[model samples]
Target: MSIISLRSILDANKLSGNNFNDWYQNLRSVLMHEKLIDVIDKPANVAPQKGESNASALDAYAKYFEQSTTTKCIILASMSPELHRQNESMTPAHIIAHVKKMYESESRTSIHRISKSSFKIRI
Candidate 1:
């Protein structure tokens, strides 16, 4: 089945909504339970940005965004620790604006990097 179809089934069955990470986790669980796919984690070798500690919630959400880049970056930024850091200037609104800007002006070379990766996304 298609990704949208699978996602629809989950939503229709009340398995998920408004929580993409949880939705994907549950979807993968179902796919594995049905013996339809193998388990894989962090299939991409791309590393987190330098100085972005993995334990930081911002890093965690960024990683999630990297895995699911099709999702809005604002949504990812909404879940970032940077939004909550007392010293940070990154308001959710700021993040939203930056996300929109990045989305609209993203370079082709960045897109090429993703396409060149060998990770498989099985339905």
Candidate 2:
């Protein structure tokens, strides 16, 4: 797919800290639809050890790494400036994990509060 197309989509759905789940879902859906999920889902396979013929694996790794980094950059471009600053040095996987941690904690805390309120009402 063209970079222009991807950029346009990201521009329209740009993320700015809040609404992370929605932003992530839309971004992921677009990426998957473009058949570029492997770039984010799979890391480059390890190189072969000494004395082993690793030509094919090396080639695959190189291609995967290139695409992965490109995809990571694209995804980063859609994030908020603060999020980008915090995660600029991170790999795509690490960035994703960080975002999930931030948002999922909010969800968990909400659930806990709701449960506590229910218990209080019963008691």
Candidate 3:
């Protein structure tokens, strides 16, 4: 997808201190649609040195790095200026973790509000 179009999506979903869950879900959906979900899910294991029994890990890491950088670009393209500033230096994995923390905290607050309101209803 074009970076300009992706930036438009980010602009529309700008995070203004709330609505983290919706923003994150939309961002993730976009990333998935771009076929970058592997960057969020699978990280390459450390490569063994030459002469080690399991040198194949090196190849895996190479592949992972290639895909991960592409994924990072997609994510960066879809971030608002504020969110991008917060995570500009982070790796793709760390960016996802940071977003999850921000959004999950808000989700808990929403759940609490729902439960509190539910208890106030009379049968």
Candidate 4:
């Protein structure tokens, strides 16, 4: 019901600028989509109850993260890069590769895999 910037959300959580914003933005999109689903499911109803509890947009976001083990892990992984380093020889390429693997392995396929030529970190 409210439009909050990704920055505000991250700031509230005491999270610095990182991939969390991107992830949260995508998650917000997902939350908006579920809101659309709620409107479709209940035409006259504003607040829909999920069984015994009234489900809000935040609840949906929380439920999604709670029930989905892979998504939870992915979120944590994005926040903590140190978890990916198993060996001292790990290069940026290796880190990116591991992230790619995790993204591919997840149930969600939203992460884009761009060709090297298409992506340049520094312009």
TM-score of each: 0.21, 0.72, 0.64, 0.23
What are the per-residue Cα lDDT tens digits for candidate 3 across 44-91?
455567677654676777777787788777676666778778888888
Full-model lDDT, candidate 1: 0.41
| Candidate 1 lDDT tens digits, 8-114 | 44444331123434534555554455433321322323446768676766666665545444222223323434422421344323433453354333444555566
Comparing 1 with 3 on lDDT, the higher-scoring candidate is: 3
The Cα RMSD of model 1 versus the native structure comes to 19.3
Please say which candidate is ahead in lDDT: 2 or 3.
2
Give Cα distance to truth, residue 21, candidate 3, Å: 1.5
Q: Whole-model lDDT, candidate 3?
A: 0.73
Between candidates 2 and 4, the one scoring higher on TM-score is 2
Best by lDDT: 2
Q: Tell me how many residue pairs clash in candidate 1.
A: 0
After superposition, the stretches of candidate 1 with alpha carbons farther than 4 Å from their true spots are 1-9, 13-17, 39-123
Off by over 4 Å in 2: 1-6, 48-53, 107-123
Q: Which candidate comes out best when scored by TM-score?
A: 2
**What lDDT is obtained when candidate 4 is compared to the true structure?**
0.40
lDDT of 4 by residue, 6-122 (tens): 333323442123344454455445434434323212222223445546446657656543434332333344444454344224432343345446544442432333333346654
Which stretch of 10 consecutive residues in model 4 shows the poorest summed lDDT?
Answer: 37-46
Give per-residue CA lDDT, model 2, range 62-115, as digits (tens): 777786787778778888788888888987778888888887677667778999
Q: List the global CA lDDT of all models.
A: 0.41, 0.75, 0.73, 0.40
